[model samples]
Target chain A: MYLAQIHVTYKPSILDPQGVAIKDAMHRLDFDTVTDVTQGKYFEVTLSADSAADAEAEIEAICDRLLANPNMETYRYDVKELANQ
Target chain B: MYLAQIHVTYKPSILDPQGVAIKDAMHRLDFDTVTDVTQGKYFEVTLSADSAADAEAEIEAICDRLLANPNMETYRYDVKELANQ
Candidate 1:
């Protein structure tokens, strides 16, 4: 088995209103040291691939096709071999 | 400055329908090496804290108060001091 941890984040050019809202809320709650916040999606996927390379290929395809928007967002993933299948 | 990367995921006992749906989509896409999938929230927070320890403390508090629902989700974060600050 292999495990892939994927993070899909908005490109720096995108305006993230939700992140701004969260930062504003943090300030209201007096955590004023917070200077910036960016929100994104995280996914953990377990695969029954024969090798780590195959697992990574599958994950990359998955992210490109479904998890991330090529224009607005970018994604990266770390694939690791699981101790047990 | 400090940067904290926070991830909030559903507790093990919680049902993740979104994750199931994503996995189903993956199967339909013919990239069926995936055996399981879990989705979560990711946050990148920049703070002007005096030290990494302080930043970590603040992040923990932020997660507890706003980023995560204690009843259904659990959060973890990594905080490191920025060289430019």
Candidate 2:
């Protein structure tokens, strides 16, 4: 088995109203030191594959099709091989 | 400075179309063993503060405001103090 960790985030240039809202909330909550809050996503997946190569292929497919919105979001991933796999 | 690691994920009960699409993509890419792909987010922030208590307060503010979607998504976070801050 392989473990894949995926992250998805809005492009920095895009306007993130969610992030801005969070920043405003922080200011109101007395946490004045926090200057920015960027939102993103993460995924930890277990692959039933035997090797990293096999797992990478699968993970790439996942990112391309579902994990990322090619137009609005960008994704990156890391894969680790399980000892027992 | 303090560092915050924030993770956001879709509620387990919610339909994760993105995750499903990734799974299908994996299958098509010859990685049949990947059964699921649950997506989430992560954030690492450097705070301009000196203590964990202060940093925690700020990070909590961020979570409430922008880091998480309280309605459809769930979030969790971890904080660590940096040596120089």
Candidate 3:
């Protein structure tokens, strides 16, 4: 099987209130060295595909279609082969 | 400045409803090749630290204290130096 690690993040131009809140919380907690924070989604998908290329194609389609909003967010993924556990 | 990309994910034993929902949604959308999904948090932090080591230390502390639930989640991070843009 192939496992894909996907990261979907907001475009830099967008405003991220959750990130801002986290940054503020960090300041409140006394970690003022952190200047900014941008929050996003990370997904790990296990696919029943024969090859990494096949898994990549399926995952890219998924990301383009559902995992990320094309307008406000962008996504990237890495595919790795997994051995049965 | 240093930029830290942190990934916080649930332990393998934990249930991830969000991931399950996304998998179901993918099935509904006709992409059944995906067998399983796991979801987590991705954070891009811009820090005004003197060096990568310092940023890593601070981020590790932040992750331990506020960013993740130590009992339920495991976290990892990558730090990179960003050139002024």
Candidate 4:
């Protein structure tokens, strides 16, 4: 078994309203030190696989098909073996 | 400067459609070993801050305001010094 950590984020050129909102909130909260705020998603997946290579292929397919919005977002993943499971 | 790695994931009780869709895709791709696929998002931020404490507070504000869906998602972050920047 292995664990896959996936990340999905908006493309840099795209406007992130959520991030903008956060920045504005910070300004109001007296944290003037915050200049920019960008928001993204994170996932941890447990894969019941026999090998890392197989898990990688499966994870890539997952990203290409559903984990990311091809037009506005990009995805990446890291896979590590489960030491006890 | 420091780098903040943020992760956002759906609450376990909440249904994750994106994750389910990825699982189905994995099955179609002939990787029968993949039994479950949960999807999430990740972000790397470069913070121009004087210390890790300030960065932590800033990042927490980011999460409470925009990085997470308070009703359905959970968020976490790690901050590290940027050695070269």
- Candidate 4 per-residue lDDT, tens place, B1-85, comes to 7778888888889998997886776677666676676666666656678789988988887778766789998987899987973
Pairs clashing in candidate 2?
A: A1-A85, A22-B65, A22-B66, A40-B41, A41-B40, A41-B41, A42-B40, A42-B41, B1-B85
Each candidate's DockQ: 0.92, 0.49, 0.86, 0.46
**Per-prediction TM-score, please?**
0.97, 0.68, 0.93, 0.73
Q: What is the C-alpha lDDT of each candidate?
A: 0.93, 0.77, 0.93, 0.77
On residues A1-85, what C-alpha lDDT tens digit does candidate 2 reach at each position?
7889888888877887877776677677777787667777788788877578878887787778766889889988899977872
**Candidate 2 per-residue lDDT over residues B9-84, each given as its tens digit:** 8888898888787667667766678767776767766668767887887677767776678888887778987676
lDDT string for model 1 (A1-85, tens) is 8889999999999999999999999999999999999999999999888788888888888999999999999999999888863
- Cα lDDT tens digits, model 1, B1-85, are 9999999999999999999999999999987778899999999999987778888999999999999999999999998877873
How far does residue A12 in candidate 4 sit from its true spot (Å)?
A: 1.7
Q: Model 2: runs farther than 4 Å from truth?
A: A83-85, B1-3, B8-31, B44-46, B51-85
Worst 10 residues of 4 chain B by lDDT: B38-47
Would you list the rank order by TM-score, best first? 1, 3, 4, 2
- Pairs that clash in candidate 4: A41-B41, A41-B42, A42-B40, A42-B41, A43-B40
Give RMSD (Å) of candidate 1 vs. truth: 1.0
RMSD to native for every prediction? 1.0, 4.0, 1.5, 3.3
Q: Identify the candidate with maximal TM-score.
A: 1
Q: What is candidate 4's TM-score against the reference?
A: 0.73
Q: What is the lDDT of residue A59 in candidate 1?
A: 89
lDDT of 3 by residue, B20-46 (tens): 999999999998888999999999998
Error of 3 at B59 (Å): 0.5
